[model samples]
Target: MDRLARRLGLRTDPHIFFWSAGLMVVFLVLLLSFQQPIGDAFGAGREWITTNLGWFFILGVTSWLVFLIWVATSRYGNLRLGKDGDRPAYSNLSWFAMLFAGGIGTVLMFWGVAEPISHFASPPFAGVEPYSVEASQDAMGISLYHLGLHTWAIFTLPGLAFGYFIYRYDLPMRVSSVFYPFLKEKIHGPIGKTIDVFAVLGTLFGVAVSLGLGTSQINAGLTALTGVPDAVWPKVLIITTLTAVATASIVAGLDKGVRRLSNLNILMAVGLMLFVLIAGDTVFLLRQLIESIGIYAGDIVPLSFWNDSMAQFTDEGGWGWQAGWTVFYWAWTVTWAPFMGVFLARISRGRTIRQFVGGVLVAPAAFTLVWFVVFGWSAMEIDGIGGSGGPISAAVADSVPLAMFAFFDQFPAATLVSGIAVVVVALFFATSSDSASLVVDMLCSGDGEAGPVRQRVFWGLSEGLLAASLIVLGGEAGLAALQEVITVIGLPIFLLVFAMMFALIVGLRRERVPKPVEAPARHQTAEPRPAQESPPRAGSQT
Candidate 1:
């Protein structure tokens, strides 16, 4: 096997790849084979955590935000990620575009319209009347809150940590590198390998969540537009088809494949948003955009700390709301952080610490606010005016996959717009899979070498298989189950993030202090320095 692998030019940490993929395949197989039992178990465990540990997710994410800001504004902010004088490999436009494409562009597409509309019907707090003006305002506020800085802050930490340690210290680009300050040479030992393994696993599950949801939305779009049956088989087929597409890109490597795909994803997304903004309520969206920013800015602090226990004027939906929405979003972001972190670091060489934090936490977040404003506010206005017969609300209630399509239904050339939305989503799905495969490959091969095509293709296939299995086994229920499992898995990662932050601070402080030069030996005299204005030496050319 080794000789054959050598001949094929396929070099990888076989244990990392095989163990990660092998374990994933085993788990997926068991879940598919015994869906009911696993779903039941997951559901029970999920409820327990959502009920008990909701506060932890809230606190963890809030601390991450504070920590990220401090790092950005601190004395270390000016430090370059790479050696002094190194410049960014990619252009700023491509850098930010890929950030969105990798982090949660597909997630936004899946939920931008759907979540706010859902919140409009049921505000997070107890007393707000559903679908009322107050409800609508709070809905966008909370949606922005979730998709806004708090979430970005979570994603930024690992990226910042990875970039700082990996490039600055010449450390290998892997999840375990974040712990180098604390672990030192131990990062190469079993503990370090374990961290990397968990990172690969976390990334696998995180990407699966997006892939499964995107596939569901694509399935819904097809059914809505073409009268295609929305069944497990169709979703499975969608996964298979798109995974093949993603496999081709994954083989092309990051610069050619992921970068180009991400740029294309951003372009498609911008076109779709522009179409909605212009074709939908232009003035209303503009007003909502300004208002949403104020609301998010004014209420972000309270909202960041808002949890079931803190809901003073309570309702029955208190803890349930936190679990279903806030905790779930945080958990999802935390789980996806490993993949986002590595990918961000990969593209972030030559940037300063401040530039990285600002770009990761600010740019994508600003885009998210605008996205929710246009998609969320427009959906709310349409539903509010349309009443019970409103297409947007009805879709949100019955089938979230169809919500984006339903939102487009209120506009001109609805079918064309919906078709475009589907294509954009497909590309988001592909970019996400392609990037994730790269991250997992790095984890397996234990560096940023991009590994071999075989390894990338292997992880890509594993991701698709896991996503397909989850969709087929549990459908929407299965996706929820997977999310619950993710939140559960995120407990350790949450702690690891805090450790990384501490390690980063220590690493930066050490870097900031210049190493002292030793005195010359007592017997040895220093060479005399030449005078700057000295005439040319005899051997100098004049």
Candidate 2:
């Protein structure tokens, strides 16, 4: 096996790479072989987790947000991720661009319009009438809540841990290294390898989910523009085509491929958001942006902790809504933590803890707010304030992937903007795949360096294949299958995240305390003659 790996130019820790890849392959085969039963299992698992463990998910995520806030504001905030005086590798623009592109770019594209409109049509909580003005406010607020600080906070914790350990303590760049404070040298033992294996699986599933969603949205765009049918094959072809692009990007390495594409994604996304804001009711969106931010800030605390226990009995599908939306979002983000954390750590060397947390939590989140207001609020207005059904809301209900294009159809250059939307989603898809592949390679490799081209390509193709298999399971059932898988897998990773928090706290405390220097040993003979070599003068050389 070693000889074969070398011949194929693969540099990896055989244990982690083989175990993680083998398990995924086995699962994929099982999924395809017994589609119905496996799909049903996924659904059942999702229901069980959401019904029983919903509060754990809610509390876990909220705690992450509060913990990050405390870390950012406390005295520990000034600690640099690297050695003292080290500065950030990427500039603010490039850093923010990469963070947005890698972390949430594709998601924002997929859900910016769909989520808000869906919530408007059916508000999550009781007492908010769907399609009413208050419902619209609630919709935007809920959207922001899901995508804002809480979501980024999930990424921030692990990223901070990885960055601190990898850069400051000179630990290996793996999820297991985050627990070095507890595990000590045992990080290289089976326990650490197990943690890394789980990281690989979590990352694989997480990125696969993003790829699946992006493929769906891309196919919907194609269907809108070229009259192509939205079917399993089309989705497969989209995934295949973009996965190839991602493979190429990964081959080119991070700087040449991921960074450039990420910057482009940000530029294009900004252009789209600005177009929506200006072309639509500019005043309404501007007002909505401000009002929605206020609403989100005010309601964030209560909503973060809300589990809908009372509403579950009183209102129909109340817990179902929480399960489908909030819990799902939390679990999804949890799975992505390892991936995003590693990726963020890669780009975040030399930055201060405060800068890292604040940037991860605020900048992308601020853009997310603007994105929701522009696309989401615009879709809501086009869908109408009252219960009168509109095309955008109808599209969201019928086929979520088509929601963005449906909104585009309302504009003048429907085809052109939709085409642009397709390109943006495709770029996001590629960047996400390639970056995730890069991170997974680091996890699989013995050292944290990029491995052979074949290894990168292998992981990249694996993600696409896993996504394709899920999509082929039963179209929408496939998407649901992946969602359920994420939720279930996230429970263990969620516990791992808490352990990481504890380890990070321990590590940070040690970092802040000044270590005492050992005094020179006293001479047994009491010879003090050699102590008088003092400096001659302030300006004179001795």
Q: What is the TM-score of each candidate against the true structure?
A: 0.91, 0.93
> Best by lDDT, which number?
2
Q: How well does candidate 1 match the true structure in TM-score terms?
A: 0.91
Quick one: RMSD of model 1? 8.1
The true-structure Cα RMSD of candidate 2 reads 7.9
lDDT scores of the candidates, listed in order: 0.81, 0.85
Q: How many angstroms is residue 108 displaced in model 1 relative to the true structure, after the best TM-score fit? A: 1.1
Q: Which residue pairs overlap in candidate 2's backbone?
A: none
RMSD of each: 8.1, 7.9
lDDT of 2 at 280: 97
Clashing pairs in 1: none
Candidate 1: tens digits of C-alpha lDDT, residues 436-463: 9998887666577688788789889999
- Quote model 2's TM-score: 0.93
Off by over 4 Å in 1: 1-9, 310-318, 385-389, 476-478, 513-542
